[model samples]
Target: MDKPDQIPPLSIDEISILFFNRQNPVYIDVYDQQTYRYFIYPIINRTVFFGCLIITLLRPLSHLERITIEQGSSTLALELAKQHTLTEVYYQKTHEYFTELLEYRESELILTKGKELGLNMNSIMFVTLFKISSYQDLQVLEAIIHRLVSIIKQQMARTEKIVYGFHNKVTLLISLSSSDSDHISSITKLLDSIIKEWNRKDGPPLNAGIGNSYYGVENIRKSYDEAGKALSYLTEQNRPGMIRYGEIGLNRFFLNQKSEEIERFLNEIFSPLWSHKAKKNELEKTLLVYTDSNRSAIQAAEKLHIHINTLYQRLKKIEEALNLSFNNTEDMLKIELACHLKRTFNA
Candidate 1:
């Protein structure tokens, strides 16, 4: 209040204080004798006598209040630190279980350990893999990951969960009651909110893939693998956001295959279509739309913005060139899978 208008703009700390002050209302202790005396007596007597008296009276109380706040803060900090330490240790152990990366014969031992660590072994447990990208600075990436982890912990504060990070990815193991109906929907909503919260802070691009919940220790690795596969589907197609493993369908199997293998599989099924120079791309589009539209010629034509007769002619050409009958269930199945594989590889 005594300073001139030549002050610099607010520093980070000053802005933070301003933010906190705006968020929290200011409180006035009107009943305090010191406040009453200081404001009223200073105006009336215009002397330092009451001011000195108030200070002398308030000194001990101020000291005691300061000590109380300090000790309370210190104790709270220690308790939180201890709790966080224990949580991290449990998370590390869970991470180790995943790190084993294989189902072993000593699954009972691992299950016992998990139960002891507060994991609900008999309940529905699954994993979600999170990946952060588009950050070139290591320090910024680390900070973003840390912020994301904090957000996860906050969001799942009421749940039994294990959160551990390695490199640029985080693995979250969440346990739900077996009777919790609509688990996938609930999980999706939770993850969507978490991602939105992170986005609100202008955090890095985040993507997650959720695995199906399974019982028993042997399926833990499978769930983790499924989560990774789901995430791979997102990355391979250059898409973002969350995908559940069950939703990926057959791509789950193909995702584990090598690129060359996928290419060969695609080529075997699509060679004839690719060999057609003029309409290869068009034919592929037709096949994909045909199957995706549930083999409804009218729907496919409407989507393709062409007449039904034209769609029929294109289908005929496709069948003739591929030396297969769309009427045959096996042939149609192959065509459908080929389309899926083509998309999975973005070919």
Candidate 2:
């Protein structure tokens, strides 16, 4: 059995912990009107899941003196276990109807005893859900998500929520705490797992947003907004399945300008090449040579490893395509600006 992940920074010698290794635990808890199932699968360490099976089991066990499960599903009752004199909840399970009953008999305690069992208040948590395309995949992902969150909630001791919306597409947003701006271990791990899974599934493009840290309820909405913007700009950045708010901040430098898109601007400025059907690098070379030579064909020709007559012929083609004289300073400015934009995109 896999032991509960250790949450660090203090002595835990006397603390009682339950183990559930072999596989991710999926508990079926039947509540008054719902069957709550807590699905657990740990990747880097984030447990994600939801269902009726979990609610059913948690109700009875959590009423015991104290039970500590790796995942958060039973926390509601277990949190109050010891304080309420019902702290004897115990054991984790894979599945089935009466697991909670066995746990109750084994624990011999109730909710009151389990109050101190969890490291709840100190936990920093971020949660968000995505609406996905297929309901079929939902069941599959449930246990995996549960296991992932359980690890983070136990080890990192920070709570996180990643939801898959119940819409046409699978949209996900996860929030995590990082003391340093440079490192976000939990969030990065989630992204890696999610991306890998997306690749394996190979469905329509996966659009995702990752929210940065925020302190209060109000700030959380901002983080979500940032995540959404980051997601929308995925096309500009291309390769999907992951995008960070910070990445969106870097996109402003790429927006189109007054008269043309970046691609079209490259065309107008490289217009000379279109007439001769010359390629991108060739057009760039010609401009650099002309600019460096101070409009001297002889010097430019030598720089290009071409005869002066050949250089003259290329320049004539450019002039004809642009319908402007090579000697015109205004035309030179347009070429220079276009080249600048082109280089900016390349770099």
User: Each candidate: what lDDT?
Assistant: 0.66, 0.44
Q: Return model 1's CA RMSD, one decimal.
A: 12.5
Summarize candidate 1's per-residue lDDT along 1-347 as a digit string, tens digits: 12222223334333333333142212222333223211111101111011101121222246675466446545654564465456556556766776653454565776676666567777777889999857665543543455477778888787777677655888888777764667657766989888766555545678888888887555777888889888988887776688889989877777767778778878877777765456457777888899889999989999999999999998998899889898899988888888877766775
Model 2 stretches with alpha carbons more than 4 Å out: 1-158, 169-178, 201-203, 253-262, 273-275, 279-281, 285-347
Model 2 error, position 172 (Å): 5.0
Against the hidden reference, what TM-scores do the models get? Answer: 0.64, 0.39
Measured with C-alpha atoms, the lDDT of residue 230 in candidate 2 is 57
Highest-TM-score candidate: 1
RMSD of every prediction: 12.5, 17.5
